[model samples]
Target: MTSTIRPSSVFLVSGGAKGITRECVIRIAQRHQCKFILLGRSAIVESEPDWAKDCFEESGLKKHIMEHLLSQGEKPTPMCVQKVFKKISSSREINNTLSRIKQAGGRAEYVSVDVTDALAVKEKVAPAVKRLGSITGVIHGAGNLADKLIEKKTEQDFETVYAAKVKGLENTLSYVDLNYLEYLVLFSSTAGFYGNIGQTDYAIANEILNKSAHLVKQKYPDCHVVAINWGPWESGMVSPELKKAFQERNIGIIPMEVGAQMLVNELDAANHTTAQVVVASPATPPARELDSKLRTYRIHRQLKLEDNPFFMDHVIAGYPVLPATCAMSWIINTCENLYPGYRLFSCTNFKVLKGIIFNEDLADEYILDLQEDSKNNDFNEITFSAKIWHKNLAKKNQYNFSGEFKLLREISPAPTYDFAKTPDGNKINENREVLIPNWEDNNFYQNGVGMLFHGLSFQGVKRFLTFGKERFTAECCWQGIEAKQQGQFPVQWFNPYAVDLSTHPLGIWLQHFYQESALPAQLDKYEQFARIPCNKDFYVSGKIKSKTDINLIVDFVIHDLEGKVFVRLFGSKFVRWFY
Candidate 1:
């Protein structure tokens, strides 16, 4: 972890004299007491004019200017009054920024140089670096906006917005020596990353800055080069009408203090891998394009015992086998990542074709292949098929897992189905003997104490509420260690440990009624109505739908304390496991 800024660091900042950038400059000066060479296009008045010197307020200055115009025999047009007001106000703002930085125990100097002019930038910045010392950091925040659709925009309109960001960055970096630089912060906009409707030129210019940041970071591996894609801030740029519209649409506006602190935090952070990032509230509109092109993606993975300590708890018959729920987690998490704005609604036809057993002859790596099947743009739904396999010289396709996943743009409402009570409203069949485990040991899944073989991590059955021929319910809690619990994979949408416990009732019923233990074979469907509750007591109810000599099919439902169904596993088939 390296400190990015020091008291002796010299930062050349563009567009740092006003607006959000000025706040960041003031904060940096306060924290590090570093010197700043602030650049801007506006030229400030060294002193107020004689007649307007007495006026401090904006309205008073305007009145004096109007009276002075009348005495000089000139027309005081509305446009003339506004033009003078802007100059005086801008000069006052620049002077205040400089004074604030100095008050924060930092030295500062203002340079009126247009960043878009490469020769002028070189002429102004080279002399400042020579006198102050070698440059250590650069904050490029200069930008202009020409908000218009491409059809209505003129060529000059595009250049006016594009020159300030793209050309300005190129001109500023040309004279600085990158070998000794420690930080490079580029102020980009969310309109560039997630394109806005009327900001084509601005988006294009800022995106170039983003790509340039990545390129520079690769060359200077030690420098913290980050391009922040900031959303709209509470500043003079956002008009009242625009602010009202943003509120109506539930979009977020960044406050001035918060946005400034984010810049300082980014510089102070020790992470060097993050080169481009977005800094915005969660309400920022994401880029959603209904791309229907068919695509196939492949990702490779390798599993080892040393990397996955949690697998030690799941050993069956002297070997650690990958759990079916964890395998499903891989497909669900990968699909969600491939499509940014969609979540896994349900997974169907999920089967464990071959369980990945951790043995001496395990393959070096496995490949996960995913292919898009269909997409419905109207409903914002998509379907894809995925399989985990390893190439073998003798075999053609050795798939370890396969499933079809459906993703939805929004989560479905929590289902209202009671799994606790029987549908026919019949009392429990008490004639059938109830099988209960000893409370002292709580060893339902221990190696020899119980029929099933599972270690402490998978032992989630705390106590049984009811056990009968037709239905059985049990209280369960997540007892597994959270750190690196999913073996080689990580938990994403839902906890696999909790999901694994939901199926335990099915296995328990088999051992109680038929004197046999079963393992999950395949799943007919898994629908997530709501998120599973953690750090609290939840219940799982399993009702036997059908049974045969070879297998048993059951329906398992997990619900919260209020008896609202959160997850439903329909037609879960399990085959008897013989020891």
Candidate 2:
């Protein structure tokens, strides 16, 4: 980090002579005693004219101006009086700001130029830079407001609002020397971050400033550049009706003093990595909802070990294979993002037709296709079928994974386990004899002689309780992998590592009895009753319903010691490599 401000710093500030920007400029002068070249559209006079000078109050002054206009045989309309008053007020404010800055031990020069005019800006700014020395920083706070609904807005309205913020910054940046620049502060608005009614043009302008900050920072990594998305304040463009509307909607207003001080402190701060920030009130409402209509959608993604580091520890037979659970996670995460308020409750018919192997670059890109099943959606339940596809070396499209996901507006209550029944609707036979395997040496997941070949992060089996040809039960705990250090594969909506570990009993049983390596083939259904705690021990019971020469069908119930069910996997099928 490097310091952003100094006593000798020179700043070029637009719209720094009035309203919110004026407050910020005064604070910067008080803190650093820096010199400024302030730009505005209003022309300034050195002294007020004698006709309206004697009236001290605003009402008295307006009356005096109207009277003087009438004496000159001119009609004194309301709009004419207002126009003259605005010009006079603007000049007085600019003069007062310059006097205040001087009293605060800083120097300022006011340049009257419309920033939207590129030629005027260049001519005025170049002369100011020649007189004041090289520029060091810039504060872009110029903007206009033309509030109208999109249907009622004209092209002129859009241009007026857009040019003040976007074109003004562009014109000003043409004159500054980036080699000498240390900080760039862009004053955006919250309307751009979260859309507000009747501010489409205003939002578009501010949003451009937000994106331009990032582009500039990318080119100048050493500069402290930031775009503040400020919310509505107590003054400065806040009308009385608008303020009342904000209060009714529970949106907080930023105080003038607090907001101005925040700007000065940021210039003096020592951070440069952050390119954009939001200095708005927290009570703002969320953005508009996305369309919930059922439709087919496709998403594309590139796969590599560098992007998914968790796969480095999920190797099989000297090659990294994508875990079946991760494929399911990709589907659920995508589906959840598609619909804003819906949550995934269950999945059905999830099958891995082909496993993705990272040896010799089998594939680098994949596409996920999701189609909504509108016929089955009823009573607040929505369902979608999803598939992951890739092209083989022969350039033919092939699918690797497929599943059906169910979503609901509200999650159902957590389910309770029945000790008398199995997960696949079968009666439990408690008196059957079972074999308890001895894994005290902890070689179950080790290489070569071990039953499984998972690396450090994937080996989460603490111990096994019993094993049999027909059934088995185990006590397993998470391996406590530092998922944060591994990056994006941490446990999010569901714990994939824990579910992967639960399938190990079948793998171990197949290897121990038949001398055949087993891999998951298809999952008929999976329902989550509650989130599985990764730090605590849990129990897994697997029942082999039937076995053929090529495959085995099994059911699983995962629960705690007190039989509180966390998840159920029914009609899962595993097969050998030959199948």
Candidate 3:
């Protein structure tokens, strides 16, 4: 609770143009507590910001995405194709940025400056003070670290890198009104302290930042100047040599988003974030890889999935054609076992496929909708014409979600097959067929994968839901925020199918509460069942399953393959009588 206090009103971010800085800028702006003045070498436009957005994607990220697209021979998008990376401020990108801020009801001012220049530095820093009144925090993200040897490096390279960083720091500090600013963050490299073999110039520059932290604090007691030392991230700098080195060392990629979050967490409380070297965690290629290898090492050697075509090297290669039914079957089999029940599919035109499989018969119709959702921005209110109860009708329903596990419908089990008694006294049985009801809904988008105890809605299954006071819906649905009620606690990825509670306090009261429960779902496929009818005043249909006891036998059977000219029919018939 104490951590929620918002920071000061204005934040000045240097190097707000790219990489980890981009995430930093975004995170700060997202807080909506401060007006962001983004200063960078790239283009930025504050007032009418169509152009400033050009700086959002870093050059390295752009290159990765472009290469990925171009390899497929796709027509390049304007954001990726043009050398706009060099264009700091364009009329268009700047205008877009400004427009976006205004639309969001936020304030932003952009100043493009070469932090490398001292006079330009004073020029950029002074005006910000005059406009914002008192600049409370300064994130000294400006940095330049060229990979080179100390002996082979030219004097210009050293001077250019150091002057820009060290001088930019001095120049930024000089212009500040000592009373207002509270914290200053400087981006330093871990190489400054640890020292890499080839990056001597980079190492020296980082060392300077590390060494100067104390001097900065003494000079400005009213504010904090922190030098943040970071390690190399895999998807960054796009360094081929570094990439090769990492591969050889078997180092994993450090996600920029993780590093950005850590930076924000530190920024919220202090001026400098006060660290010599914090490791900039959320370290990538987590130990899970090693754990996974160790877990399968024995079994892997015993039963190798790497048969001829299934070999490990076949990973990067795609199959051109199938030999027979075994060809597609092998792929399905491999993929199924590799990531069971997690494959995505597409069954429509001009859109992507996603979501978990529900039922094969149902999936035939559902995939088209999944494609539609992939193309549509808003997840709420996407409807369809359905033949419900043998009646053809058009119905509108809302379940705010995105991404289709187009494969999900294939996995949909008939909930009515095993009619367990609801905590309340109501009979829900498999023999009764139900009608799909329609209703109105309002939802908020959510983000993240952790199980939410409160907001509960199934992204892949929406047929059983309705709109009302206790409706299952997610708000702020992005990242992992699903508008669903409680989930299996502590687990990252969880989904509760048509889950409703009757005994809990929030259950009866019907308020949104988030918590995690590893409660297992009861899955059964019913050919037809009674409709769980939703009361107009509430969300879901109030139906309960009645219990029954019967004598039965369960048996596991083996099958035989009937081979003809080319194909084989594999099946078996077994009897398990019940009363």
Q: Please report the candidate that would top TM-score against the real structure.
A: 1
Compared with the true structure, all predictions reach lDDT values of 0.80, 0.80, 0.40
Q: Flag regions of model 2 displaced more than 4 Å.
A: 1-4, 44-78, 81-85, 88-107, 122-134, 145-162, 174-178, 188-262, 271-317, 321-329, 336-579
- Candidate 2 has which clashing residue pairs, if any? none
User: Each candidate's TM vs. the true structure?
Assistant: 0.61, 0.55, 0.40
Q: Residue-wise lDDT of candidate 2 within 1-579, one digit each (tens)?
A: 464567678889999989899889999999989889999999997678898675668898899889988988999999999998888888988999999999998888999999999999988888877877678989998989989889999999999999999999999888887766888899899888887879999999999999999999999888889999998888888899888877755578889999989887777666558788888754333223334667999988887778677787787777888889888888887876676446677899999988889877477688999999852334456789999989888889989999999876556777766442222212223443233343325456654333366666666665455565677676778756665534544565567778888887677777666767667899999988777777788888888888888888899988886778888899998876532
Please identify model 1 stretches exceeding 4 Å from their true place. 1-4, 50-64, 236-251, 281-579
Instruction: Kindly list the per-residue Cα lDDT of model 1 for residues 114-208, writing each as its tens digit.
Output: 99999898888777777777888999999887788899999999999999999999888886888878889999987788777678999899899
Worst 10 residues of 3 by lDDT: 555-564
Better of 1 and 2 by lDDT: 1
Answer with 2 or 3, whichever has the higher TM-score. 2
lDDT for position 568 in model 2: 89
Q: Global lDDT for candidate 2?
A: 0.80
Whose TM-score is higher: candidate 1's or candidate 3's?
A: 1
Instruction: Give the top-scoring candidate (lDDT).
Output: 1
Pairs with steric clashes in candidate 1: none
How far is 166's C-alpha from truth in model 1 (Å)?
0.9
